[model samples]
Target: MPAGSPKVPVKFDKVQKYFGPVKVLEQFDLDVAPGEFLVLLGASGSGKTTALRILSGLETATAGRVVIGERDVTNILPKYRDVSMVFQSYALYPHKTVAENIGFPLKVRRVAKAEMDSAIRDAASQVQLGDLLDRYPRELSGGQRQRVALARAIIRRPSVFLMDEPLSNLDAKLRGYMRAELKHMQQALGITTIYVTHDQIEAMTLAHRVAILDRGVLQQLATPAEIYNDPANLFVAQFIGSPPMNIVRGGLEGRYFLTNGARIDSPVGGHVDKAILGVRPEDCAVVAPENVALKGVIYTTELIGDHTLVTVEIGHDKLTVKASKDIHGNQGDTVGVALRREHLYVFDAASGQRIR
Candidate 1:
């Protein structure tokens, strides 16, 4: 967002969608703050794309309202809605040079020739594509093509920017580089952007707030930090983290929760009978045998470059712990693990909701 630019609010009120008899979205409600980067995250068939398509005017909702700055855009045409979209495929014209591709939108809007040239040059520079302006899409690298796509989107200077997995095709190294670049570009442009992705890391890294959906229902809408540190329910706790959280089944025993045969003080909420316990890999620590919170035998130690991922067996279940670079633990070793009590997550076994 620019220093003095006004904010644009986007809202989805009671949105619903169905494919024949199958419902893809149900009573979906979301409010995106002005200049906020909101990511819609979910697995395939989770309706994330459908939501984006609805906003893009490519798909119509069966019920509900899509609003941009208080205007009901549910029935508005994509071109008239002041929105620009960048797709995963780049979707660049094969024979058109980068400059022509970017200037197409401006030309469509009848922007004056001189103004279009200026806008195209500025957008090309903004995306570091100035040097490649004469190159056709077929002559560019994957990253270069993506930049051209981004440049085209920026040249429109629309109020809202919609991106659907714009970096899914890049290689690992390029994906990482572009992730940071995309974040920086979005911040610089200050557009009200809505990004849709199935990658949890992308959602966490790029979003001001994430809106997670599953089975057509919204599970959570919150800041990335809040969603990660304080999950609203079991699905959120399980979905937000890399390697996911360690969810162990336990029974309440004598004011403490017992996993396998090891005893640890119960988290704040428990029924003294049964509950689901969750601990992040980072929160699980290796401790002296006598001070161990749980006794488990190391089943495997996976070296993931910078850190070792140790999976320990407690009873019949396996719990993964992220070991620091300097911490050494071998496979099949009897390890004493201590789980941080304050960071423990407790959820209802039946409802899957947080108990405390």
Candidate 2:
């Protein structure tokens, strides 16, 4: 907490992983700055978990190195790596009380009885599980059980925390509450954290930086805002947003792109035969007839409290736009759609990489 305090950093150098003959990670490299909350986000089987496993020393990298605080730990044992993990399953002993579960790690390390007791109490209080310390695992709710797991992790006072979808078991509401708590706890502890999850919302809200993975490849790594606003590729754009990004198949006409037989101005000026246009739902708007760049029939409308999602049929593809409920429209009616020119994202159709 002092100004001259030392800092720790986690770095991955050209890491690769293989399960027997199948390659699961390809030259993966990443850096987690000291006291940073880094999130690894991807779909199932995207190698996010594998990367975390490698970092926690549960799984070894087939090639390259893993370092923490300037130390190469590629082949270090899990218990001696100065890292604690909170798994999706919680991994709590069903027969043990909350206090016992929280003290399990200290017990394994043969910590002094008095010191172990103090650590258990501190961890329980940190996670607000002090009141339920005597309760068995089955007596606690899903959220409480998750806290128990987190308590156990924090008690170790490890330099880094590795969490793999630790809150995935809880209900949506509980997950949201725990997310805020997790971030606050990380700040209070000032320990570097590497979180692995498939939920983009979780990554956006809790992480200082997010690494995106897909099919055993590291796609893009950036701050949440950058990844959302300036995605490096089509996959990152489509995967990071809810309802996903509105990617439409279109062709280039001069410096403009053709969208549903209408000219949508392109930010970049070169002549290309084909390309795709990506527009976030929030950036797409409904405009007056003549002001519209593209025209399409409203396929469906979903009103979710403060905003509404309108799905429109633009030629053969459907695109969604977010708008206020006051803006009235009905299904099957023709509506004018326009994209915020400056906010448009252009990507190469064939390569699926960002062109602008």
lDDT of each: 0.88, 0.90
Put down candidate 1 lDDT per residue, 227-299, tens digits, no spaces.
9999999999999898899988987654577777777876674454567789999999876657776888889
**Which numbered prediction scores highest in lDDT against the true structure?**
2
Clashing residue pairs, backbone N/CA/C < 3 A, model 1: 1-190
**Cα-based TM-score, every candidate:** 0.95, 0.96
Give the number of the best model, judged by TM-score.
2
